[model samples]
Target: MSSALSTVIIIAALLAAAYSLVTALRDRAMGWDHLAALGVLEALLVAQMAVGFVKLAGDGKGPDDTATFVGYLIGVVIIPVVSAGWGLLERTRWGPGVIVVACLAVAVMVVRLGQLWEGAVV
Candidate 1:
């Protein structure tokens, strides 16, 4: 895994979380901008997935628990898409609030991804 790319994903996830939180706090419901942000995050995650697979395929020096690593990657990739869908189901601020939670969850997953890449287990 590229540290630079990891850092970029982490930072972008954090920013998405912050933006969603602020929107939720302001009682702003889901909007185009929020969806756009989710779209951007989704793009980043897809890129990460591609890079991760390439790295795993090339060296096979990643986490011992392949299932978990791949699971996290897959889950992270699907989250924003699912959240965006859920957000559309409602017109309240809580819709966006749910997205905020999802963003934070993705951030945490990114941290875990780093650890797993480093061969940590629990």
Candidate 2:
């Protein structure tokens, strides 16, 4: 896995979380601004996923729990999409709250990915 890409994803995820949380705190509904920030995060995550797959396939060096790692990778990618959709449907401050949840999940998954990259078990 590429540490630099992972760091980018992690930082972006956290920033997304902070942005969403602030919006929620301000009692604002979901808007293009929130979507734009999360869109940037999603783009970075997509790049991270692509690079991750390349690394996994290249030289065959990966975590012991390959299935679990892959599962987390997939789940991390899905979270933002699902949460965004949910937010759009809800149409309230809860929309940003949903983003906060999604971003936090992605942030945690990024750390987990790093742990898995380092050969951590389970």
The Cα local distance difference test for each model comes to 0.86, 0.85
Lowest-lDDT window of 10 residues in candidate 2?
52-61
The deviation in Å at residue 11 for candidate 1 is 1.5
**Alpha-carbon shift of residue 14 in model 1 (angstroms):** 1.5
- Quote model 1's TM-score: 0.94
Per-residue lDDT tens digits for candidate 1, residues 18-95, read 887888899888999888889888898999999888888898477888888999989999999999999888789889
Q: Which residue pairs clash in candidate 2?
A: none
Model 2 lDDT, full chain set? 0.85
Model 1, residue 88: distance off in Å is 1.4
lDDT of 2 by residue, 1-122 (tens): 77888888889888888988898899988888877878888898888888778878985678888898888888888888888888888787899999998998898998899899888765
Clash number for model 1? Answer: 0
